[model samples]
Target: MSAPERIPPRSVTTAELLAKGELKVRGQIREASNAVLYCSVSYEGQDAFCVYKPVAGERPLWDFPDGTLAQREVAAYEVSEATGWGLVPPTVLRDGPYGEGMCQLWIESAADSELLALVDDEEPADGWKAIGFAEVGEGRTALLVHADDARLRRLAVLDAVINNADRKGGHLLPEGQDRLYGIDHGVTFNAENKLRTLLWGWAGEPLTGEAVETLTTLRDGLASGGPLATRLAELITAAEVDATRARVDALLASGKHPEPSGEWPAIPWPPV
Candidate 1:
């Protein structure tokens, strides 16, 4: 007899599914050296898609300790939530196909949507901001640009506060009409100044009143020894946690977007 047809599970909110899901690895993301998997997570008979990165699959870095990237991913989510920007998707630390690691709800966007795109000999389009120009083949330079939306600006602020070391162009994902999602936050919250990204358009710009207020709230939340601070400690070193607090303080004091200090490369290679 033929096998019975399978049934799909019901859908639920991203937060609800991530909190109680039973993760099952379905396929491997071969492009990533680290063992990243595309997973189907079912919770309370509701289904969700997630990206699972196991601790065991993490590759060691000279600067970052081993097996801590998963923790960093979860920590990034906490920061996103604490800032109330909801930039990072719902992510949790859990045992999965390979081992304990970060399991984040996968955000869906338009198949043809390009969060960051390269343009040549074209004026700035409406609703878009030119970040910089990059060299293409044959001595051609292309303008690198991203959506000039408030949601992305909020993410830039979040990246500054978290001391994100890598914010490649591809990290931004379009959600709804006016929403953007940020991912790949495993290299964040370092003790040193490692802010690298393609969001230079807002450099030196003063923080909006609302942005400053949100950051102030984040600062107070971390200082009060709230859940965010406690969770960060479990994922990263105490020194790194301290550094995070310090970064928040610095941002509040400056009250403006930070500029590249030239200590490290200001942008990630393969900008996209």
Candidate 2:
């Protein structure tokens, strides 16, 4: 079976959905700068959050086929599951009146303290308390301070190779005080997308023993006949995976800590 999106309903096209069922607006729960309105979809007493991107004016940053976003996200989560990494739920696709957008699975996430509290004092964050690295002030520089931290750094490296662009402040969570859950990896592993987000601070650095082990496992897992290769291919090109693996191999060989490449301080902001 395909990886379940943890959704209230299975995938469907917007037009078909509207024709067959009625969507009771669950009120605007979230908003992006698009014509899209994220509404809770209802069908036969089932409900899920459906993002409707009305076909209209064009935005510079938004260049994706909206309908496919859900499928791409679904594929990413499936692959991440193979590696035991926690990314977000997949977006569900359906043809709509305006155009094809996505129905995203809801995530019950809180802003991580290690990510949000340190970045903005006014931002009241209630997520992910640091157990060992308690002294770290905020996430802006937490990547620097936690450079040597085992789990945090491992997440950083894993995201880097995956080319995650939206590893935002709220996308990470702590499970049972130890495991780190990373989510919303839709904008990753595309060749043209060199998105640098808040998570790039640890690039060019040496991998920790644990990080190295994880990378190594990822490497072998993406090989021919390997378990995750099929999933990785869906999120990235074969060439892309090859490049990512090469970078990982280089990091392992160096046996040094991370340093910024100084190429670009960051990728474009508000990556669609």
Candidate 3:
């Protein structure tokens, strides 16, 4: 089967492509979770941007689908959305010269343009810490800090439920002090073993009234013909999503708050 002829999926959209956009953007290699090469495209009559993980038209060591990572990341974003948590927008996975590939919606570029890796295990040369800053705009000088553990803990629970393996510090974008944006979630919600992350340090801890309320809303709201269903389905498998729903039901039925389980108060590291 001539390797299933490659097809051009939907073109990306950029709000800038409209009569008025911030600036004319050319393809630039910006640093994110991993070294991401990207370009600006018009999306839905808006000046949107897409970041792509380029393949050198060759096979990787894993020898899996060439570009499948991109697709998996898209699924990651879907589950994040279902949680009503602000996360990286969705992208499409297409066939590149070598194998499967991914593309994603771009957030307003940060001043540092660097990632927030706690440690340097799976990153490029300079890493998220070393990348110097460029003034994207006037007031956007400082990098968003993950100083807020409470918020990270909340996100960690969502990551745990979704099984996000790479919820590193760098994947989070600090819009300002209070606002945060999460990205690069390709590794999530798989059928095999779950890679619960650090977002749930407060796990067995009592579920906050707000936390219980949010889980209830998500449980009641998530269904087949829902606004966020398509995105959620894309992020997780049917079995996994159903399992999350079941867990939520059990938690709510028990009327229990959230807390950490086992010896560790949080996920071994932090956040969770």
Candidate 4:
């Protein structure tokens, strides 16, 4: 089967697309724990592509309730939009061929971009920042590296705020110049310190002026019972929403990049 075209699926309202889009499953992602499908959605005489993860296909997790992953993906988009970072692509919780699922806008990353790896011997070349190191196996270690891009730095901040438990190497997509977009936010906002990621590069660095301002704005917005909170409440428990609020406060209080607490796994399993 031919792959779906790399189309930018933004433009129309999410609700309108969800109601009108005719979803045709193109293929399944066998690597995902749950049923993940690439699909073509036609709506209002326009065609777009999306990644769909149905609630019924979700594998049960001990920490999270059953069938909440798809909504969590939508919640991540809400937070991303509220912060004005646009780190996450436009996403919506809509019914698809596999039933209710998260439908996200397709992003076509620049072909030249490479998957960053944490290496030990290699000094970070230009455009790469050394984050931290991990034990590979048999006492061998590797240094975690990331692109030295400001947008990605901002995404690191957003990951902390969301308590993202899975910031894999493959999640960061580079597009148009230095733009970075983050995806696969199914395991977020667990009302616990579940921030497993490879973004420890700025572990002790002070927050950039823009990051502080954006975080401050988000905190205030959530406190005022704003649209972000309303949208999150529809997907997650009230406790989890309150936890997200607390996380924002904690980041602001620290005023610097967070260090791994050693309470949970610092990096996600498989890294990518």
Task: Point to the candidate with the largest lDDT.
Answer: 4
List, residue by residue over 18-88, the lDDT tens digit for candidate 1: 75688887899897768889989987878878899988888888888734888899999998999878899
Q: Residue 221 of model 4: what lDDT?
A: 74
How high is each candidate's TM-score?
0.89, 0.57, 0.56, 0.89
Global CA lDDT computed for model 1: 0.83
Output candidate 3 Cα RMSD.
13.0
The residue-by-residue lDDT of candidate 3 on 1-272, one tens digit each, is: 46887886555333223212222235556444344656555434455656656434223424222234555566666556566665555555543323345556666635563323233233223312222222336655433222324455456556655555556655666565444667766555554334534343344556667657776676765666555555556655566656666656666676553444444323222331
Worst 10 residues of 1 by lDDT: 109-118
lDDT of each residue in 196-218, candidate 2, tens digit only = 55554445555667666766777
Candidate 1 regions with alpha-carbon error over 4 angstroms: 1-16, 112-114, 121-126
Candidate closer to the true structure by TM-score (higher is better), 2 or 4: 4
Model 4: per-residue Cα lDDT over 59-173, one tens digit each = 8889877338988988999999999988998888888777888988778887787647666665777778786677889989887788777887899999998889999987888
lDDT of 2: 0.51
